[model samples]
Target: MTIQKTISLRPYPRGFHLITSIIEMQLAEIRQIKAGILHVFIQHTSAGLTINENADPTVRKDFETFINDLIPEGYAKFIHNYEGDDDMPAHIKSSFFGNSLQIPITDGKLNLGTWQGIYLCEFRNQGGPRNIILTAMGA
Candidate 1:
């Protein structure tokens, strides 16, 4: 069986956000998937996705702090500053984190670890609503 859908998330601030609940709310179709893989892909190049700690908010904050220090906005060398100083750095951060994630599905539900959850790495200050494409495939 296979199911695919595109979902839009309300805009979040420039930080990492846990979106597992949101994704789970939209998985009614996958309730019958039995055993499968859920492939989540972000539509924007400046924003990306990952699976990480969800119980601690500080972990998300630390991610933002570290990535920002590594790729601070407004470096003199970036040539793709058409959008803003955050644009190029956002792309670079997105590359570092990546744009897609795959989670195992068992018994019609996500098989995530105790601390694992989906993260929307909003790279830009005003990245606006992000789009994510979800695909589930299995026997």
Candidate 2:
């Protein structure tokens, strides 16, 4: 049989980026399921998920810079600005990326690449609590 669990995270950021509770959720799921696959997802339009190098802080910084460069703000071409300046941009970044990821499970553990770690990408610029939904399913 398979079971699913949902976890939430309150990220304090407006356009600040952060790597969220994927590791902790995965660890807990592994303890419950003897063997199977794990799927982690974020239920937000302006947020995303990715697997990246968590060892070096610079890596994350570089990524933030790169993402910002890819989608610079203050564009008169944007239409969705109801939330704020960062709102439309956040949606763009999320569109460029994704909202979910699936990891393989083996021997009651997630089989991830040595340098691969799950992260929740926040594109909002204001520092406030953000919600993230994690769902895990396995036998």
Candidate 3:
């Protein structure tokens, strides 16, 4: 069986945020899925998705710091600046982390590790609500 749904997450600050619970809440149908895979894809170029530490807040904060430092805003070389200084850098950050993620499903639930969680990698300083398409496939 296969299922797909698009969800909109509330606007979040420019940072990596744990959205595992929000994603799980949208997957009520997954409880019937004994074994499967969940594909989460972000619809915007300025934002992305990832999986990482869910236990500590520092991890997420560190992610924002590291990526921002690595890809600072307002680089004089960027050509896509109509959206603002964060435009080009956001797209670059999105590519590094990616726009989608695949997670194994087992026993009707996400088979994530104890500290693993889904992350909404919001790169734009004022990114609005982001849309994510969730696709689950299995028997």
Using lDDT as the measure, which candidate wins?
A: 1
Against the reference, the lDDT scores of all candidates come to 0.94, 0.69, 0.93
Q: Per-residue alpha-carbon lDDT of model 3 for 46-74, expressed as tens digits? A: 99998999999999989998998999987
Reference-based lDDT, residue 103, model 3 = 96
In angstroms, the error of model 3 at 89 is 0.3
Q: Which segments of model 1 are wrong by more than 4 Å?
A: none
Output the TM-score of candidate 1. Answer: 0.98
What TM-score do all the candidates reach, one by one? 0.98, 0.83, 0.97
lDDT of 1: 0.94
User: Which residue ranges in model 2 land beyond 4 Å of their true spot?
Assistant: 14-27
In angstroms, give how far residue 5 of model 1 lies from its true place. Answer: 0.5
For model 1, where is the 10-residue window of minimal lDDT? Answer: 25-34
**Which has the greatest TM-score?**
1
Better of 1 and 3 by lDDT: 1
